[model samples]
Target: MISRTLETTLNALALYAIAAVLGVAFFDQLVNGELPCPLCLLQRAGFLLLAIGPVLAVARGPRAAWYGVTILAGLAGAGFATRQILLHIAPGDAGYGAPFLGLHFYTWAFVVFVVAIAASALMLILRQPDGEATDEVQAGAASGDALGRIGILLVILMAAANVLSTTLECGFATCPDDPVTYQLLTPSGS
Candidate 1:
């Protein structure tokens, strides 16, 4: 029972951390008016993907399969970020969008993905199997704690915001390689 509670708490914290990263990305997009490139969107998707495992763990108890999902998402996200970083590797290239804290969003994404992967791996290593499953331990996860619930809600909200923003920016067409304005919002004659 204790271990289960600990796991749930940890999952809640992970969810909050992931949500914060998503929140920062969203804030930058809105406040700076810098549209996300395709790769940037992919990285955001990766972050959402990474959150799934923890969300499941909080809602349905920790499972190895869920952690595996997180690890895979982290790997995919890191690869996307790496591709973007490589694109701007040339000495004189100005880099994509703008730098946040002296590093591009992709760079920060890469770092976050690495840290998430490591943390998931550590959680997997530390998780303890229930010796004799009590009803409380078995069913407790269904009633996730308040913190976990809040974290889950925040992530969901972020996902919805991303979808709305992306639709506005790209419309139904492929997003431009270097988007200067919201395609759907712009005058058709412009």
Candidate 2:
């Protein structure tokens, strides 16, 4: 009973995150036309990785298949968060540069990345039996697997929403032609 509840919670969180990310991407990226920075895109990829874990568990009737994927997602999120924070703090010298500290976008991405890492950590460590999360997802004795399938299906829909948002935002975040490029080659005139 405990395991099933925990797994369900974890699954809910993962799907919820996907939906949130997708929502942000749509409103900020699709509507605004603002593109993601390199780090922003990296974070999106991290979210995708995290989404894989729950999806696998739901589709395959087992969560074990996504263990490594979850860890990788956490690492990716951590890496992107670190990079964004550093970039915000440090200035780039030449064509390769960092954002001036205090960009709203950077701050938002950092927060999301942190949340993703925490969520992934919890999901990976939570207890479950055998490779399959089967017994846990089983509905009370009478209902069988219908509820389980419905839950999994809901997660899938949420995941799709996330993917759609990321795709839209990722397409716009890359700003290649800024006039004032920052890199070691060219120090800031200001």
Tell me the whole-model lDDT of each prediction, alpha carbons only: 0.86, 0.55
- The C-alpha TM-scores of every prediction are 0.92, 0.59
- lDDT string for model 2 (1-190, tens) is 2365456445645666665665565566555555555566566666666777766655544354465676677677767767766755655533223333434554565566566667556655665645454554451221224444555565566557655544443333443433223232334475
Q: How does candidate 1 fare on TM-score?
A: 0.92
- Residue 124: error of model 1 in Å? 1.3
Instruction: Give candidate 2's TM-score.
Output: 0.59
Who wins the TM-score comparison?
1
In terms of lDDT, the poorest run of 10 residues in model 2 is: 177-186
- Superposition-based RMSD of candidate 1 using all C-alpha atoms, in angstroms: 2.2
* lDDT by residue (tens digit), candidate 1, 1-190: 2466777778888989989998888888889988888889999999999999989888877777888999999999999999999999999999998888999899999999999899888877777654443444643654366888998999999899989999999999999888889989999999
